[model samples]
Target chain A: MKFLTPAQVTALMQDAVDAQGVDLGQIRAQLVLSPSERVDWLIAAVENLRAFRQKL
Target chain B: MTFDPRVICRILAEEGTEFVVIGGFAAAVRGSTVLTFDIDVVPDRERSNLEKLARALRRLNAQLRTGSEVLPLSINADFLDQMQVSLTLTTDFGDLDLVFQPAGPKASYADWADGADHVDLGNRLIVAIAALDDIIASKRAANRVKDQAALPALEALSEQIKSQT
Candidate 1:
């Protein structure tokens, strides 16, 4: 994946804060998942998305 | 620009672009399914084709970088001279990698519309992914520890295919 520019990351982070009612920091925390971890990476990714969108 | 990876694969296939499925989608195509967000294609031939591809991307406003710096928003062509390029796309959605299969006598291609069991992607075109049998061979040839770990599941799928055959 390409690196997100600092500005773009900040803007996206802000949007998540305004649109979802969760914490972006927590969501970012969950984005990293091992490909073969036995646990469901998709489920973890979803929670990350929710945590990212905690504004509304 | 914004296209579904499967759809893109089908289109490329129709355009006579020969490729093999890799990544999570390849596993899914082999029936040990997993969620895949990007298209992973390895061309049947490398070298000349890869050079042509590098020139094409050079014209597309893509900046090729190396080292600790992350890949730019488009394909990187700087490493093409080495033979194959592992093309990665990073979009607003996520990231996908399409690694070109290294060329020469060692290369192989998949057959589409094998007419037995097939899933039509669009326009009646199907994803002629590597057969379960071949996936086993490749994962073994890859020989990475992680890839080896996937061998049993792949072998099981191959066994199932053999039984069906």
Candidate 2:
């Protein structure tokens, strides 16, 4: 597993919220999960979803 | 009155309480940590085991406080399979806190029972112990409250693992 420094985690959260099209509230909630859990959460929530549709 | 916390586990073992010594006490025995205190035992138990713990508390007049309710002689067993029982009861003399953990998550007594090493507690008795990695990982997993406690041990274990290479 990739270990994200505190700063990196913070940046990722900021970018997710700053995205003009998405809701900041939901992005922040995913970050509420512990730092260790966020990667898995994002992988399952975003990456996998993106992949699922790309494959189709 | 015994300085050794295992005294309580030994007593419980004799009393037919299905329990195992865990937490820092277990770590100390395994030489992972220098910490010592009253015994923390995870009992082989089911739901409502607190009633039995209450009876033991009555003997020591332990002070139990949860939310607004206060019951003397309290204990913490977060999990049935990995419960922690304090052989030391709360009283003026001093108190021993027994914390419990249920099965799974490497915090369970069942996990310890299966994977925990056996150490002699004298009198030809042996008790189950949690894995050093499991101990460090679980404590760290708790982050804030336990993360600090886990740091030194984790560092030590990391050194030991590296040295073994």
Candidate 3:
């Protein structure tokens, strides 16, 4: 495998950090949901997580 | 068991137990894209309300959640009154946290309810949701590693809400 230069490695790390940072787009998408829909979304998400954890 | 907050909130409302939803779940209600596995609520400290909450808890079959094992919970008005900080419990609907005083300036249930946003969750089930600002303040005051991690997203969501309104 070709080794990346130090500067390239640093840039890649920064890009990874940026990817993990807060996504305003996702937040805005959630905001489009009504209060009740938001709650529904939360419940569904939690349920899915629980199922995934159980399988693990 | 599934983490069904609607069933949990419905039980509380049906029992006429007054409370304000808080913590990560409240953040999500306020449009934060955070995934909370449990429901956190600050219940009214009145004796009658505590009694109502006790009834609701019993209906949910709530038991104290412990690291080693789940302990049986004896929920009563006096028992709830003596709980100075918080209690974590597991119910059929999933995990539930009863927060007597959240870590923030507005510590009491009434204080949170005063500025809470009333959300109608359909089915004639309207519940009080702690304001996004209060949620952010409490998370800041909490300052836990997890809380700190969640703050950036929560703050961004709060700013977004403010910009709109």
Candidate 4:
């Protein structure tokens, strides 16, 4: 119902990405992407994070 | 060559399909850190929207992912308007699960609409994604091993979001 602001959503996403072992360097590299492309990279990052966790 | 969930989301959004993105993909969008191969959505069961949903699925080349035989059933307006249960399909993009009943506190897309958040993925791809609380409730209600495992973190994330407000 209530929507989180874009800032809040970004902060939560960063926390989850860090907790799931996605590195800052990787995200930094993706920062250059357009907003749309950045969304794609983030989705891939989540998949990679899960794949990394599965190997452990 | 797996396609992102966004691919399907864009297709449905462009077709004006009335749906709320739910399940794991919703969790991921909300920053759950959970990975899901499929995109699950609860399409509005209204006769008009259901027809639109069928057309969108057809455009994606959806095939039955459930039964032993992978038939590409005609997801016509009749099927959508009449089907009582959820439908799961495999597509070029990936797995796409269309549910009328999502099995939690909010069992239907109609139940979830009030709480849904419209997400703009840039490039004119706008989707209505389920709220975090609803996703957590749905997962808890589903109670599968993976769903259970995801709870702790989702719960923590939910709390974190609450605290920020």
Question: What DockQ does each prediction reach against the true complex?
Answer: 0.03, 0.01, 0.60, 0.10
Off by over 4 Å in 1: A1-56, B1-4, B10-16, B34-38, B46-69, B73-85, B91-94, B102-119
Q: Tell me how far candidate 4 lies from the true structure as C-alpha RMSD in angstroms.
A: 9.8
DockQ-superior candidate, 1 or 2? 1
TM-score of each: 0.49, 0.52, 0.89, 0.76
Q: What TM-score should be assigned to candidate 4?
A: 0.76
The digit string of per-residue lDDT tens for model 2 on B36-95 reads 434456655555455454444444445643446545533444322243432334433223
Which prediction has more favorable TM-score, 2 or 3? 3
RMSD in Å for all candidates: 15.2, 17.9, 4.1, 9.8
lDDT of 1 by residue, B91-163 (tens): 3323344465522222443331131134444355665554545555556777776555556555555555465
| Model 3: residue B137 alpha-carbon error in angstroms | 0.3
Q: Considering summed lDDT, which 10 consecutive residues are worst modelled in model 4 chain B? A: B27-36
- What is the DockQ (computed on Cα atoms) for candidate 3? 0.60
* Residue runs of model 3 more than 4 Å from their true location after superposition: A1-19
Clashing pairs in 4: A1-B115
Top-scoring candidate (DockQ): 3
Residue-by-residue lDDT tens digits, candidate 1, A5-52: 999999998666444533334323222322222123443444455567
Error of 4 at A30 (Å): 13
Better of 1 and 4 by DockQ: 4
Residue runs of model 4 more than 4 Å from their true location after superposition: A1-42, A46-56, B67-69
Determine which window of 10 residues in candidate 3 chain B has minimal summed lDDT: B117-126
Candidate 4 retains true contacts at a fraction of: 0.10
Best by TM-score: 3
